[model samples]
Target: MTRTSSAPLRSPVAALLAVLLAASGVLLGAGGAQAAGYRYWSFWEGDGKSWAYATQGPSLVRPDDGTVQGFRFAVSEDSADADRPRHAPDFGAICADTPAKGGAKRVALVIDPGTTEDAPAGEKPPALRTACAQVAPDASSAEALASVAKPLRYDSSAMICAISGYPKSGCGEQVSGDGSKKDGSGKPTDDASASASASSAPAADDGDSGGGPSAGLLLGIGAVLLLGVAAVFQARRRR
Candidate 1:
């Protein structure tokens, strides 16, 4: 009696499954890896009452007279997770001391350097304060900021990275999410008691910057597909 060889058939099936499992892992890792959180200044515009995430960067926005511009530095996944200025956007209170000019516009600016917890290692946050900028009627928000917060720093892409040399270095660096939240909830805390002392600054102007699959991800997918095809071909050949 001749015994049929089952080993050869089992080997190909096992190899095929192994290849498929590896492919699944590659796909999962490519898609599920935790995103790196960013530490950067989030821009905002405020009505007299509340803050709204700025849709346009300061360089592009021509803030109207009495417009309130806000900047907050923090570790956040996106603008939605960013902390708003601690104080309310009271344009009247911020610009009260500065009289209006005939040929210029006045913009109230709020700069929050964030808590020490969110500051870069070995760095401390600057005091939070407001500023009233007197700029040309058509001047952009950036111009308005420069009027008070001079010596502003910007990255190669023209993105505002720092205001008044707070951090001193780095531009939108990636950081872990540990201790990322302020007050346990990523919402704005209305610190109405904070004084509206006049100060000034400039900050980041881009929206959430992201990209598609990386080169490594594409290479991993290609390799997995190739191995799967080879295993299937070998299994059929052994028949």
Candidate 2:
């Protein structure tokens, strides 16, 4: 009598189990790497054509005449994912009404409070607007912004929390990737209805913020897991 050995089937089963465990490890690692993001205002500078992510903070960069400064508030992982101002950086159009001053510089400002989705709970975003600020020749971008959008709110670290008292409170707080504040029921919370008092403190520079893993990274990991699952099923059938 010839006996068929079960070693072949067992070997494939063990290999499939190892693959499944490795896939779980990948998923956990990916989830940890793609943790949370921050909701804050991202500063930008623009030429006559397009906006550029500012390398230096608004307080450090000095704006020249005809320069355009932009401020966008949204939930972002980092500067790469930051939402830019809605309007274009049109210095000629923004400062067209205001005549140039000899002793002062003309800097156009584009302020976008972001969409309703990005606004804090129980809060509405202010309309996107443009203003031409006339400031001293050596005024920094932050000063230029303050010249127009006054009553800015700052945190203990000097980070700008609210512009024109929009959100009422909170400074660069960490939120879900989608900018939602969820409760135990997995429903969004509406706890942003706080006092509208503005802070009298000076705003500070928000330097380059950090980010987490991208969506593509998570998707790729999921695909690998699915392929592994398929391999496990195939091995079972072979057994």
Best by TM-score: 2
| Candidate 1, residue 86: lDDT | 91
lDDT of 1 at 170: 64
Model 2: per-residue Cα lDDT over 119-232, one tens digit each? 888889989999999999999887888888988876544456777886787666667655665333221112210110111111221432224344665677677778777876
Tens digits of per-residue lDDT for model 1 on 1-239? 88677687877678777868777676756544444345667778898899987766677789898899998887765554567889899999999999997998999999898999889888999899899999999999888988888678876445666888877876566554364322232221122001001111122224322223455666777777777878777776766
Each prediction's TM-score against the native? Answer: 0.62, 0.70
- After superposition, the stretches of candidate 1 with alpha carbons farther than 4 Å from their true spots are 1-35, 179-239
What clash pairs does model 1 have? 130-199
State model 1's lDDT.
0.69
Worst 10 residues of 2 by lDDT: 193-202
Q: What is the total number of backbone clashes in candidate 1?
A: 1
